[model samples]
Target: MQLIDSRYIMASPEVVWAALLNPEVLKDCVPGCESMTGSAEDGFEAVVAQKVGPVSARFTGLVKLSDLDIGKGLTISGEGKGGPAGYAKGGAKVTLEPIEGGTRLSYEVEANVGGKIAQLGSRIIDSFAKKMADTFFERFQTAVEGPAEAEEGTDETQKKGWFKRLIS
Candidate 1:
């Protein structure tokens, strides 16, 4: 499946770029990431657990950063094994552009799955991929720019992500 999306972050391109290479920020922002280690130059190893449709699995993967343009953009690609559940591999081209007050972070992602997971069908897999991409960017934005302004009359505690709310 393929997905494209973008978000405006209230930070400079440099700051956003730094966060993208930060292992702590990535570990915290990735929806189900349990741990991540390594550097942007050497690539990272990550363990993540997630549930998609009726399948649940823990994935161990290696994520690499390439096509570097300094504070401008890069490509992140990775593949993971989920035992019998399936395997997933994908790549995303991320771009950063300075805007009026911050940076416009955009991404185009393409992913493929195999084994039993692919049996779930494209509709289910597509929706899950979209959600994963959305969640990652949302959490990344929050991590870089801090908590979003609480909506009027909305309880601050209603914010998503248990860890994010706790830290905020």
Candidate 2:
């Protein structure tokens, strides 16, 4: 499947880029993430636990970051095995563009699933993926902008043209 989305973050590209590369931030923001241990240069081993439909499993996998352009974008690709449950593999291309208020973070994602998880059907998997994206970004935006700013300007952020045109 393929997915695309964009969100306006209330921070500089530099700050956002740093957050994207920070394993601590990623572990906190990403749903079902148990541990992401490694470096950007070498790659990371990730342990994630997630429930999709009727099955719940813990997946241990490797993630790699490449095709990097500093302060702009990068590619993230990984695959995980959930024992007999199934496996998932995907890659995302994320780009950051500076805007009037802050930065526009956009991503194009492609992913696939197999075995029992795939047996749950496409619609279920799609819904799960979208929810994960939204939740992840919500946490990430909150973390980058801080609780005070994130809470204070909800109405204003909605009014921004970039936001209005990008996601909805």
Candidate 3:
């Protein structure tokens, strides 16, 4: 599956770029990420547990950052094995552009799966991939910008609605 998306984070490109390279921040942002270690220089080793469709598995993998352009962008790629359930591999091209208030974080992702998990069909897998992407970006935004809060002129209901759109 392939997907493209972007989000405006309420932080400078430098701050978001630093968070992207921090293992602790990434661990918190990634869904199902149980443990993550290493650095931007050596890459990271991670253990993740996730359920896609009816398949549940723990994936031990290595995630690497490459094609660096300093604070501008980079390419992230990783592959993991989930025993007999399946193997998953994907890569994303990420770019950061400074916008009016903060930065525009954009990504193009491509993913593939195999083994028994592939039997679930494209409909299920595609939806799962899209959800994963959305959830990751949402969490990333939150991590970089902190929790959502009502703007000066916004009411409680407006804040609630904005938060709802963020996570959903």
RMSD of each: 4.4, 6.2, 5.1
- Residue range with the least summed lDDT across 10 consecutive positions in model 2: 159-168
| Top candidate (TM-score) | 3
Question: Native-vs-model 3 lDDT?
Answer: 0.86
**Model 2, range 72-100, lDDT digits (tens) per residue?**
99988889999999998887899999998
The window of 10 residues in a row where model 1 has the poorest summed lDDT is 157-166
lDDT of each: 0.88, 0.82, 0.86
Q: Please report how far candidate 3 places residue 12 from its true position, in Å.
A: 0.5
Local accuracy of candidate 1 as per-residue lDDT tens digits, 75-126:
9999999999999999899999999978999999999999889999999999
- Residue-level lDDT of model 3, residues 37-105, one tens digit each, is 999989999999999989999989999999999999999899989999999999889999999978999
Clashing pairs in 2: none
User: What ranges in model 1 sit over 4 Å off?
Assistant: 150-168
Can you rank all candidates by TM-score, best first? 3, 1, 2
Compared with the true structure, model 1 gives a TM-score of 0.88
By summed lDDT, the worst window of 10 consecutive residues in model 3 runs over: 157-166
